[model samples]
Each structure stands twice: as structure tokens, then as C-alpha cells.
Target chain A: MADSIEKVSIVISKGSLEGVYPGLIMGNGARMEGIEANLFFTFFGLDVIRKNRIDKIKVGTVGNPGMHMPTWIGAIPGMSWLATKMMSRQMDKIDIPPVREFIEMIGDSGGKLYACQATVDMYGLSMDDFVPQVEKVLTVGEFYELSAGGEIIFT
Target chain B: MTTVTLAGTPVEVDDEGFLQKPEQWTREMGEEMARSAGIEKLTERHWQVIDFMRKTYLDTGAAPSMRALGKTSGVAIKELYELFPKGPAKLAAKIGGIPKPRGCV
Candidate 1:
């Protein structure tokens, strides 16, 4: 009876595990609902699709209030690793896939994955640096063009 | 919630047309629901996925996620989409007379 969302374009800008998963989950959910979904990874978010770094993303224990710990403790060495490990275990229990598998699942479900061309250029990275699921790299203008009639979500 | 007649029997369904009482489902009702979802015919592959979904829901009290379905449904993800276009997990769950999946992934 009411209008339904037909398309969604999500921008992933932060490199932390927390920052990337939200966008991935949203994009995957959109595709599950039969909506056209696009994931545009930019700036630090490029790490998500980076072949070398994607699997190494860690939780930002330091400077993150969600950690619910004293900042000094969070800044301690090995704290982020412990946090990441714990978080990953929790996610695994709930059947959430790891980052690489999640991206592949999204791709398999027909959601588009894109890297920001400007970031790729600035970082001296090439398409080879990205996972194969990344369809292409697009500039800001191209991203806007592709997102023309859809909701743009920045995470 | 609403009640709709499928294959001549009335069943309770949610707003998205997923069955609220999945136990009320029958193969005929599944066929009827499939027709409404745009699958004019339910091939053997469709029944495989639907059977998997229904069995999983009954066993676990929840439908399997798309990833789980792909991993264990004996149907590849790409072909699952081909069998039930658009949203394979969502559409299959609906036509299989199960509640809509609650997970984001």
C-alpha cells in the first residue's frame, strides 16, 4: 500500500571493523529485500575491500566509547586485538560471516561493490589491491550518478 | 496480521505475506503462494529450497539466513536466485509458508 525503497547506496568511510560492518550489513539486507544496493568504499573504508587489509581490520578500542572501558586501558597494546577477537567470536555465534565471506555473499546476491577512485589514486593503490568482488572504482561524481534515485547512507 | 486463503484453506500471514502459523502450510498452499510470488511453476529445485526452508524453520523455530541456505540447501546461491528471483531467501520463506527471516545478514 505504501512506497517501498527501491534502491540504496551506502558509503563506508571509516576503516575500523565497527565502521565497515554496518554498511556491509545494510547493503546485504537491502539486497535480501530485493532492493538494488551499492556499496561505495572511500577514504579509510578502502581497507574493507583491500585484499591485504580487509581481513585484518580491528575494533577501535581506543577512543571508542562503545568499548565501555577506561581510555588508558583501551590504549594498552593487545587491547584492540583482544576486543576484535571477542567481537568476532560473538558474531560467529550469531551466524554472521567474516568480512571477506560477507562481501562475497553480497556480491553473489547481486549487490554492487565499488571502491573510491580518488582514494585509490591518493593511496597509490590499483584495482589489484582490491578483492575481486569490487566491480569497479568510481569517482565522487560517478558515485552520485550511480546513486541518482536512491538513498545515500554514510557510515 | 491477516488471513488469506491459499489452495482453498485460510491461513494467517503477516504484512509481508509470510505465514504466522507455518504449521498450517501444505504443499498445495506452497504452490499457491509461489504463483503469487511470480513463479508460475515450482520446479524440483524450487521444492528443494522450499523444503529446506520449511524443515529448517520447524527444527530451529526460525528460517535459515541466505548464507546458511546457500551453504546447506543443496542449492548454490546464484542458482537459488535464479529459482526464486529477486530475493531468494525472503521469497522462498514466504512461499514456503514460513515467517520472514529476522536477521540483517
Candidate 2:
């Protein structure tokens, strides 16, 4: 246990459902292990904490090799929606809560949720646009200060 | 695995101190384990969670996930953390003499 992580800072930089879930899962897992966890949402990742679009995140079917389909087929009008629905069903079967519930669970377990100030400003978003679980908007310097002594994971 | 005495009864536990043979667990052992985990005292609410965990494990052959515990244990998530510090699902399972839950959630 000597090498066990005492804290973790995870950076989420994408808006796609697959992109956001890794950071969310990791942050929640760290809290479950009694480790302090912080999730920093930057760039498109802000969608995860945004009240208006949290549920609109869809699986990135186009250009995502993980989808295992041809790029042309992925470009079809409904492919992304179909892919997202299939993924959600699979996740639901495994008892994984939807994104909003997962975020609330992490926050309730003492994991801190943060939004990047620069991204919020660039996207014309304000504190009011985010979910109540978002603890704060942080500059990069403040994020580094908060993440001191912890591993920083960029997803 | 190792055999350790808890509440005057010897029981087998794994490396991280979870019970290796859950069937050998008793209520007195659970209280002793909880006390050692800095709980000091297991209140009625505490037993509610531990009992639910044991029952679930007995029924499902695995410890309940955190999501399941919160939804069905009748304990609010915030209170679950308060009742068992750190991680309620893992800690409560440990105190209840069950293996640590393997779920990712």
C-alpha cells in the first residue's frame, strides 16, 4: 500500500460520451478507494458539467476506430445515435448509472468537480450554466496547485 | 490468507483484511472490526447497511456495488459515507466479513 495513490487529478478534454466516461469512471473509482479525486473539465469536456447539454453527449461514431465500422458508414445520419443507444443499453445492463447520476455520486463521495475558467470564458458559459455539483472554476495554475502531490491523468 | 482473532473468535482473512471465509462471520466479529476501523461504535444505521450487504452477498454470491447499496440500502449516499468513512461499499463489506466488492462503480 506504500505506493497507493493518495490523490488523483483527472483532466477531461473531450465532449463525446466515450471521452467523458473514462475520466468519470476513474474519478469515481479513486474516491471508492478512499483516495481524494478531482475532475477538471476543459474545452469540449465542459459539456459534461453543463446543465443544458449533459444528456446530449453521444458516442463519437465518426473517425473513432473503436466503433469498428467504416468511416463512411459512421457518417450516416443516424449512426452516431444508434451507436450511442447501444452503448447506453450495455452500460445500463451493467448497473452503470447515467452520466448525471454518476457525477452526483462522485460528488457525494467527496470527489471534487471543476470547470476550467478559460474554457468557460471561451465558450461564453458562466457558473450558472453548470450543474450544481461543480465545485468551482479554476485557472490552470489553481488546478496545478490543487493537484499537488497527486497523479494527473489526462483523458 | 491469515487467521486472526476478532471478538475472541479466530477467522480467516485475506491480504487486505477482508474475510476469506464469509460464512464464519458473526455479529460480534463485525462490531470488533468496525471498532478497529475507527468507527468506535456501530449504530443502528450502521447495522442496517452491514446487514443489507451480508444479505445481498448471500443472495447474489457477491457484494453489492456502491450504486446498488445506495439505491436499495435505504441509506442516503452522503450518510453512507458518514456512517462508514472513506468508501462505504468497501468498508461496510469489510466490517461485515465479506470480500471487497469487485464492481467498478
Candidate 3:
């Protein structure tokens, strides 16, 4: 019975390049615990499932809370590009991988990754835009059906 | 609340949500996480990233940035990506058994 209750589902809605990691981590963690895990990528979150752009997603440093204070502040007035470059450079200095790699890792794991149908339509993104491994393009209600009776996490 | 000792001090985590005692997160857990993340073996490179992440968390009270991890581990940016497809934060948080990080929220 305890094993039966181990399944979990997660909904990922953040479109920012930086926001994708949480969903990937949680989904992978659930699988590690022997829990059935599914990830629904909606709205901008679909960027992660996008075939080409997924690997190139960058952290948004201008308004991101994690950026260095001075750079973040300076970026307030036409310095956003600089901030993005500077932040990217700093991240490179440390050895953190890019955002796309994380998304790919989540897919490489047994976790199911889905793209939102509505977002796909709105963005005029075709199936070709998404990675070949994506489980499907699903509606919100469909996602809810998959999430029923399981932990529903939004990341 | 259940109290688990870390560095000789008691750390309280919610009884229900807590996965295990901090020290009890053994090599098995690490291996399990690695396998789930599609990593086949636990190599010295993996340990380098994990140890750096832990130390960074301890020092700044925050997860280490990718660049910081690269600098500390001497791993190239591209290679780190290959190692952790979900990036450092995801891999670190999963293996470290820390809760979802704040910024990630």
C-alpha cells in the first residue's frame, strides 16, 4: 500500500529559461523514490520541450532575484543585456551547466515530459518545434486527469 | 517536528515531509538519485560536483551558481551540462535531498 501511494505528478508553467530546473529536479526525485511521475509543460514552460530552443535557454538576470545585487540594480536602466552577459559569464566561471541540459536530463530520466496543446497553438509552434521524446501535447484537463490521485506540484 | 543532528546540532524538519535524517542520506540514496537522473556510475567527477554544491550551500547559505560550480570543480561549462542535463540546481537538490530551492520556486 505504501508503495501504491508513491506516485506523483507535477505541472511546470514557468517559461523563463531559469525557472525550468525545479520541475526537472522534482520529477526526477519522484522517480528515484519509485513514484510514478509526469511533468506537464505549459505556456512558456514549453520552451524546455522545444527541440532547438530548449538547449539554449538562458537565465534572466535583469529581474531575477538570484543575480548579483549591483548588477541587478544597474540593469534597471538599459543595462539588462549587460547584466545577462555578466551573469552568464559569472555562471560560466562556476561551472553550472546551461538550462537546456537540465531539461534534457529530465527527459533522459524516466520522467514523462509533456507540452501544453494550447501554448503550442498560441505560439504557432508545430510538433517539429518540440523534442522527439516529448510524451505528448496535452490539454489542461488531460493533464488534470493524469494528475488525479497523485501529488500535483507546480514548478 | 523530528530533530536530526547535523554537525553535532539538532536540525528540525517537518516529520511528515522529511525524507530522512541528514546523515542518513546514504550512498544508496545517492546512487538511486544518479540512476534516476540517467547517470550510470558514480564517478569522481560526480563527487566533485556534489561536494562543491554542499560546500557552496554551507558557505553562502544558498545553492551554488553554475559558474561557481565550474570554477570550483574545474569542469568546463559544456561538460557540466552533459553531466547534469537538468543543470546544477536540479542535480544538487535531488542528490543533496534538499527541498526545492527558493529561487526555483
Candidate 4:
């Protein structure tokens, strides 16, 4: 018998470099443990699952309290770009896949990806807008129902 | 704990003969373990894999998967098998003194 988690539901609500990685990495970890993993994407997190756009994700430095650098320096227009590049380079050195490949790997491991219906409507995106790995677009109520009796994590 | 002699001294190991306390593993211990696995002597190529697995485990709390090691450690799977013939991930991690890799069954 396969030792596996019964269920895990992870919420991805932000699209920034820091925000998107947690869900994807944790989802991959869950799938490795033979868990039934469901990743729910909403708001800007929708862009993470959107086809051809996942690789274009950038660092979200605006109003970030952990920016470490001085506020004025972080306010510099190109800082986010530099930070995103550095983050991507670091991830590459560690052999972490880019967002698109990472998401596909999660699917390959039997994890399910779900998009938020409200966000899909707000952005005027259809099923075609998302990568084929996305299993469904669910509402808040549907998500709660589907995730019932499972662990819910908002990242 | 099981014991494997290294340089005439018995070193404690787990049932599989991997060191029970990885931190106490010495170069002689690694070589002793390697020899038992059919690796006669450590080579630059062999060290490439052993060192990579060791360094990666020390740097990160987790050891790299065999897939990740193949991609980033600059060691081919076939060659890794050639260097550590007993079993690649399990044996190399044993010699390298890291915990048994999570994916190794």
C-alpha cells in the first residue's frame, strides 16, 4: 500500500515571486508523499496558471515590509526587475524548475490545479487562457466543499 | 547500531551500515564503506558525485533527488552507478554521510 496523505488543499492568492513558489513547491512535496493535492489559484495568482504568462512572473516589491533594502532604494522603478532576475537565477542554481515546468511536474505527480471562478470572471479569462493542467474553475463555496475535511493552507 | 571497521577501528552504523551519526563519519569511514560497495578507490569522477551529494545535503536540509543530482551534479546516471556500484543514491548517501535519501526505498 502506498503511504500517502489523504488530502491537502492549498490556496495561492498572490502572484509574486515569493507568493507563487510556496504553493507550487508544497504541492510538489505533497504529490511526492502520494497526497491528493489540490492547488486553488485566485486573484493575481490566476496569472501563475495562465498559459505562456507563467514564466513572466516578476517580484512584487511594492509595499513589501521584508524588502530589507531601504524603502527609497526599493522604490526605484527597476528594483523589482533586478530582484526577479536574481530570484530566478538562484532558483535555477538549485535546480528548481521554472513556474511552467514546475506546475506541469505537479500535474505529472497527480496533483490537481484549480482556478477561482470570480478571478476568472474578473479577468475575463476562459478555460483556454489557463494551461491544460488546470482541472477546473471553482467558486468559493465549491472550493470549501471540495476541500472539506482536508487541510487548507493559504499562501 | 551495526559496526563497520575503518582503518582498524570499528565505526557505528545503522542496520544498512550507513553511519548512525553522519557528522562523525570520516574520510576513512567513507572509503571503507565505498570499498565494501565495490569501489576500490575514490577517483575525481567518483568524488564529483560523492562530494556533490554531501555538499548539497549539508547546504540544504534535504538531499537532492537522483533526478536533480543527474541534472545539476554534472554526473551521468550511468557513471554514478559505475562509481558506487552497490546502489547509487542509497550507497553514495551512505558514503557521503547524509541521511538516507527520502525517495530511496
Candidate 5:
């Protein structure tokens, strides 16, 4: 039965810039293990599946509990921007790959990325707004159908 | 249990673990992990980012964000996008072998 678990599916519901990495990592990791992996990008998660906006996704710092209050307070009106910068800098100092790169890597590695049809309609986004590699825009039920019989991880 | 030292701290390793010492995370090890992740080769730029990530982990005990990573590593945001098309948060964490960071889910 363990060997029969040949595929893995993940659902990414969070849309925040900071919230997108987990799905990316897990999906990519599964693919590295030679497992068939699918990622269902819904709601805010659609931002990554969106072509133009995917690269522009920004970190959320306002009211974020993890933000350093003193540094955030010092930035004042530009705290969000500053926090984003600081976070990126810290990541660079450590050698972690950035979000956009991870997505490309995953796609290049043969992992499938999909957008939610309902969210596209609700957010007024169109097919042109998404990257070329996205397989399709699907509904929750459709995504569930794709994810059935495999591990469905909602990140 | 076997113990290995990391930055002067002793970390216990399971009996069958591959990393019996902190230094076991060698360039070869990193290269293999990168290859497994579908990165065929490691350029100086890749090593630069990876070394920085490791150092940052030693210093702060957490994964840094892309913006912060850029500032400290002198890698421009745009270039970062070029280097890590998937977004720095995920790729960096993956290469660093760290658990997914908070808020990334």
C-alpha cells in the first residue's frame, strides 16, 4: 500500500505573499521524490498562478505577529516595504532561494500548477493574467477530483 | 546517539543518520541536494546565496525574507528573481534543508 501511494496532491488556499512558499516547497519536494504532484492554487493563492502579479507578490507586514515591532515601528509609513526588504536581505544572507525562482524550478521539474476558476471570476482575473505553464483553471470540485486518492495538503 | 558540533553546540544524531557531524553538510552534499532538486550545477552565485543562508541561519535562527536576503547579500531583487524563479522563500528553505517558514502556507 505504501508503494501504491504513488502520487501526492496539494491545495494552496493562502494568497498572502508569505503564505505561498509552503505549497511550493512541498509540491516541489514531492516531485523530487519522483512522485506525481499537483498544486491547486485558489483564492489569494491564485496570485502565484497569475502571470503578471506572481512576480509582484509582496510580503505582509501590517499587523503581522512575526514582524519585529521596533524595526517595524521605526519604518513607520514605509514599514511594510522596509520589512519586506529586511526579510529579503535576511534570506539572502542565509542562501535561501526566493519565491519566483522556486516556482520556476518546480514547473521546470514537471510539477503541475493550477489556478482556481472561481477565484479567477471573483477576482476578475483572466487567463492572460496567468503564466503559460498553468495547466488549467478549475473549481474546488474539479480540484478535489484531481486530488482524490492522494495526500491533499492545504497550505 | 551520536553527537556533532555546530557552531560550538553539540547536536545529537540518530544512529543511522548520514550527518554525523555538522561539517557533513559539505559542498558535495549541497551539490547532490541541488542536483536532486533538479539544479544540474552550482555556480558561484548559487553558492553565494547558499553560504549566506547557512550563515544567516547560524546567526538568527530563522529563514530571512527575500527583501532582507537581497539587502544583506547585495543581490538585487530583480536578480534574485532571476536566480530563484520560484521565489526565494521556498528555494532557499529547500536548499537549506530547513522546515517551511511561518506564514508561507
Candidate 6:
């Protein structure tokens, strides 16, 4: 309680729609609080900011016990689409935006978005593959340095 | 239920201090809740935000979250805290006599 939260830096490793939304929502929520917000996307998490995939991310029903069904049932064809549709419908009732629109909202509201250079290299993806919201690609060391003095959350 | 007299009339509140009924909410009750939340005075800006929250909740049947409040109420989040103290969204919802907004904790 001695130190007030001046900033929040979130790192995302998973790429599913459920995994990606927490970072986006929390980062956007912090920005709403007038705090500095930063999101670092790595590995599969890069899909969240990818130009081609950001709008197309889906729920990973496999092994997700929250689906309330067996793993094999979740793995059935069209189940992921069904899950995604259900999630989108549920979120709509709360006025929550879709992924693409949510990303745009954050960028327009001054939330910082970054991509991991190592992951970009590993996936052989260039800046063009990322959404225009990505400010830059930062190395792990640079992220660590910039994220200093802020609360770091791994999602 | 907890009862607190507002404008000389007793009103019931839930365990979390939110009003038990939306129809029981009034400007005086909001001011009382603001006072309890550590705001000594309800300024023009505070009323603006509170009125917007109340209107939105009435129309939508849901309390406005922080994001919705900030975007539509012409009030900044930091200023909301300054007006409502400890927790702005829940405090505003409580004052507005709306249910607590889920997914915003």
C-alpha cells in the first residue's frame, strides 16, 4: 500500500480469444483509470495484434473445462466456431466490443501496444503483419527495462 | 437489509450498501451516499456524472461500467474517484440505485 500503482505492464503468452481478452480488458481498464497501460505480446499471443489474425482469433475449447463438456466433444468440428459465437453473443449483451474494435479503442485512447522482437523473428513475421496500433517491436531486455517501476502482470 | 434515512424517510439498502430498490433512489439519497463515500460536497460535475449513470442504468437495465461511464458521461475516471472516493463505479451504481455491474471488477 506504500506505493501507488503508477502504471501497469501486461505480458500475454496465450493467443485464444479468452486468453487475449483479459490483457486487453485489463489494460484498457487501467487506461480508463488514467494510469499508463502497456501490453506486450509474445509467441502465440502475437495473434492478438496480427493484421490477419487479430480479427479472426477464436476460443480454444480443447482442454478448456469451462466449456462444461468433455475434451473430445470440444474438439469436434464447428465447436470452436459455436463457442466463439456464443461468447460474442454474451459479450454483446454487455456492450463489449469485438477484438478488432477493442484494439482500436485502446489505441485511440492512448494505450501502448508492443510486439516481441524475438517472437516476430521466430515466426518470420514483419511489422506489416501487425496491426497499425503496434508502436514497435521491443526485445525482452528492453521490455524489462521499460516495464520497470510498473506493476507487471503475466496473462 | 440496512436502513438509512434519506431526506427524512427511511430507505433500505442491501448488505453491500446499495439501495434495495431503484425507485427509492433520489438526489438526496445520492448525496447521502456520496457523503458516506467520503465526498463532503456534491458539485456540479459530480451531479453530471451521477445523473448520467442513473439515466443509463434506467435505460439499459444495467449499471454502467467504468469504461461506459468514462466514454459517455463526459467525466474522466480519475475525477470519478475524486467524486466518489474508494470505488467509483460501484459507488456510483449504489448511489444511482442500480445493480452492481458484472465483469468490471
Candidate 2 lDDT over residue span A1-155, tens digit each: 35678999999999999999999999988888888999999999999999988989999999999989999999999999999999999998887888999999998888999999999889898889999999999999999999999999999
lDDT (10s digit) by residue, model 1, range A1-155:
48999999999999998888999999988988889999999999999999999899999998899989999999999999999999999988887889999998888888899999989999999989999999999999999999999999999
In lDDT terms, how accurate is model 1?
0.90
TM-score for all models, in order of appearance:
0.96, 0.98, 0.52, 0.64, 0.57, 0.68
Best by lDDT: 2
Model 2: CA > 4 A from native: none
Q: State how far residue A63 of model 2 sits from its true place (Å).
A: 0.4
Pairs with backbone N, CA or C atoms under 3 Å apart (clashes), candidate 1: none
lDDT of 5 at B85: 54
Task: Report the Cα interface RMSD of each model, rounded to 1 decimal.
Answer: 1.2, 1.1, 8.6, 8.7, 9.5, 5.6
Docking quality level of the chain pair in candidate 6:
incorrect
By TM-score, the candidates rank as: 2, 1, 6, 4, 5, 3
Off by over 4 Å in 5: A1-5, A68-75, A93-95, B1-105
- lDDT string for model 5 (A5-88, tens) is 457788888766668867887886665445678988887888887777776666776666666466457457876666667776
Candidates by DockQ, descending order: 2, 1, 6, 3, 4, 5
Tell me how far candidate 3 lies from the true structure as C-alpha RMSD in angstroms: 8.9
Error of 1 at B35 (Å): 1.8
List residue ranges in candidate 1 displaced over 4 A. Answer: none
Q: Give DockQ: model 5.
A: 0.05
Q: Using DockQ as the measure, which candidate wins?
A: 2
lDDT per model vs. reference = 0.90, 0.92, 0.64, 0.79, 0.66, 0.81
User: Which ranges of candidate 4 are over 4 A from the true structure?
Assistant: A1-5, B1-63, B66-98, B102-105
Clashing pairs in 2: none
